[model samples]
Target: MDDVHAVRKPRDSWWTVFLVDPVACRLTLLVADRTAITPNGLTGVSMALGVTAAISFALGQLAAGAALFYLSFMVDCTDGKIARLKGTGTPFGLWVDYMGDRIRVICCAAGLASGQYAVTGDVAYILLGAGVTVLDLFRYVNAPQMKRVREVVRENRAQREPAGEHLARQDPAGENRVPCDPGPAEVAAVLNEAAALIREASAQPHPGAHRVLRLYRRIGRFLGRHRVRPHLMSGIEFHAAVFVAAPLLGSWALLPVSTGAGALLLLNEIFLIYVLWLSTRTAPASPIPQRLPV
Candidate 1:
């Protein structure tokens, strides 16, 4: 619906919000709404364009590859927006979108590396391509699982907390609260539970999470008044910016830019793996309560 697009700003990367969404995705969505085209169809188009972009890069057409890559991403963004607008989103569509994203990244990276290899005759470019693909794939897979776990924890907490208590805290001004959504207390509980799950899952005691949580709290405090989510480094945004700039730098530079992106992704993957390891660890034995005198 138009409502979805009109309300709060999309909680996506800033690049998406400013660079792609307003003009590109919106225009594409407009055309799609008027035509018989479906979201899945758009997704397929995106995939095809991405493959072509990759091939173009492999053949040493950096500018064409970059243009096609950007267009592909724009169409990819359009499919989801159009689906949400038309109320035509499906589980199958979601799956296709996810897989398409992965495949696109793989193709693009491989093409860039292949092109670089052609230029320099280095086999490391091939390995660099594999690293990029693996890093992006891990991000796609792990981030969602972590998010889902947090959601489950929040839902559990919301069911446990009293409605009046939530109303008193989050809706103290008597504003109408959305009945379907959880409140602040519930969200806080969900975060706590997610942290606990991470601690439990770790093989050894880890203080890194604790330090990160403190920083997270500080950012939360700063953003609480603005009601805006904090922006952080994201692989999606990183790669987007890289690809958008790579063509301008010429073919030889694309390799170094992509390799740098891959390195960043690897670091991010490490952080994610640490958190995931904590989430899967067994919780310590519960302490027994001592008897109190009557």
Candidate 2:
């Protein structure tokens, strides 16, 4: 089992050559050892390095800062690849990954804001901070609600255990039941399907679903394109393009009004984050068209 969880492998993207993918190169070096680090350990280390990078940037070191920050991004992707290669993905591990990423992102934003203040000593720093603070505050305030939503998801699927809560061994009779059993893709699929079923069943008697369906029709009264937007293909790409690239671009180079532009763009991301959060919270799950697992 340990060997299975620690096996080295490649993915469909398959950029194993060090020269081809420098990011993957750095990560592959970490995995080249006789043993591999656990996913959560990788995430934690990544967060630490990312935080250091952000702090350095905030302190106004550009070149070294960029290299470290980029390394952070490499580690972020590497952990996911390691999980995929070894099939060691666990709910607890994923939750840790998500939390670590969120913290790193927030720190980066804060670092940028601080850097602006340190560099310019202008009132614009206050504005930038305000925008970032708003987004951070919103996420902080909503985290509990999100936790509850996840819990609801678990309970809806008849999970007595908390979502992402790792279970310790429970002995029945003379036999050991299990110890820290964490499943991968198939387990996730089953849980998601079960949750979907619960959602479908729960909504069966609700008249609100019908009214919501009608509203969707009314909203789509105009013609539309079914093609996915350049902005929406993947969440990471969308978020990175909007939040990181747009804001930090001007700050990194001596471009015309780059820092100013980054500040304004940061504000837009705060608004975007709020909208996406609300959309997820209020989204009505349509009548599931698929059959339930028997």
Candidate 3:
């Protein structure tokens, strides 16, 4: 049981942490203890369930489709937990997991759009489906690029700083660091530094931006104390909002809920982009590498 808990991600979407992890953890323990099923095998199960969910949606069984989709996601979460708990994780497993998620989203989107359009004879459902698919793709594609940009900036900063300066900045007290369990003070320090960087980058930043940053900092500190990330509308949450919440609201609420979820997702992504840009502005100048090394 302790080992199963240890497999949980240190930071993950609120949806996953609060809703999925509890269910996934028990299933993971059962699988690891009782079965010989591999992580890849679990991925296959998740994919199968996802396909069935799509079929349900195509048949206009919205509630059933939503429930199946949620179950599929639960199994998807379990696979990773089992892999981590048993130390059987592999790069191939990672690839399968990633591809499986993409395929599920695509199929679900098509199933949902077709189902809704058939019911209402509205062309807009088709467009909404495309919008959802595109938004998911954009989130996944842009996330890695944003991460790479941050890494490059960090590397550049490290290179420009005097030897030991970067390390000193990170751990000024020379205390041993626990990477997985950062304290609230540490989190606040990082947020404060980021706020300072943004202020320094802008000659006269908007009052609203300052307020937002301040609120973010406070929220970061609060969530940090509880070991929760401050990103409330990440990809996982977005998917849940669209596939689970929207459908459960019934056909009448589907379109509006999905549209609102998409908007929130975009807004969150834009906010992250703005922060990354600010960080880059404060980073030391260096030519970005033509390609990231393998």
Candidate 4:
């Protein structure tokens, strides 16, 4: 029981921990278990809500847009919770979720720009929207590459561990090397579990692939702890900020604000590129596995 408690992933976001998880995710989990609603169904609803939110913003209904956008985000959070709890996630589900998120970003950003342009006649807002779109595209594109790098690291680490060591003892480079939060002890336990899974996957590729794929779903949870996460524009932080600003800033202020945010996100993309480069460059020269065709 203590080991089980020790291996549970820690919440990385205050918003998710204090608000979204306790309220939105739990409510969705209840509804999901009691109803016929599938996770993909939730994803579809989220997509519609996001598109509607964008349209509402374009029509200058800031309050409605903000509410709708929040609803979309809530459902987006719920679907993954449902997927994990129900063991229903698949490679196809991941692709759908990925596409849905991108669609929301594009539609919402474009709508905000259109509305702002209508109100102020500034072409710069259009450029801002384009920039957000580009950054979002890059973010999604980078995720698979990051996963590939992790797989390489996992494989390399597996090869380096002593042949007769226990799985729990075979910590790859030690969790201390990663500078984890939530104190060292809890992070150490989680990394042990992660290392065990990685090593097992490396040893037995057939059943291990499924196990690793299941573990891969938690990649976002792990990567959320990366030093560069807070700076990324195409993430929950920026998404929440956009919703909050929509109602408070209105069209006139929102465009310029979002433009600045998008610029920051673009800069973060460069940082992510550098991080990926470092990982791949330092990784052992093993052929990367073909990523899920998402």
Question: lDDT: which candidate is best?
Answer: 3
- Taken over the whole model, the C-alpha lDDT of each candidate is 0.63, 0.46, 0.77, 0.60
Poorest stretch of ten by lDDT in candidate 1: 176-185
On residues 44-157, what C-alpha lDDT tens digit does candidate 2 reach at each position? 888997798678758866555556655666676677667776677898987889777777766766676677678887656556545554544554454444444444443433
- Candidate 4 matches the true fold with a TM-score of 0.66
Clashing pairs in 4: none
lDDT of 2: 0.46
lDDT by residue (130-175, candidate 3, tens digit) is 9999999988887667666666766887778789775555544422
Considering lDDT, which of the candidate structures 2 and 4 is the better prediction for this target? Answer: 4
Q: Sorted by TM-score, highest first, which candidate order results?
A: 3, 1, 4, 2
Tell how far residue 281 is off in model 2, in angstroms.
16
Give me the displacement of residue 89 in model 2, in angstroms.
2.6
Question: Model 1, 244-283: lDDT tens per residue?
Answer: 6766687566667766766665665565455444433423
Q: Is 1 or 4 the stronger prediction by TM-score?
A: 1
Better of 3 and 4 by TM-score: 3
Two-way lDDT contest, 3 vs 4, winner: 3
> Where in model 3 is the C-alpha error above 4 Å?
171-214, 287-294
Error of 4 at 127 (Å): 1.1
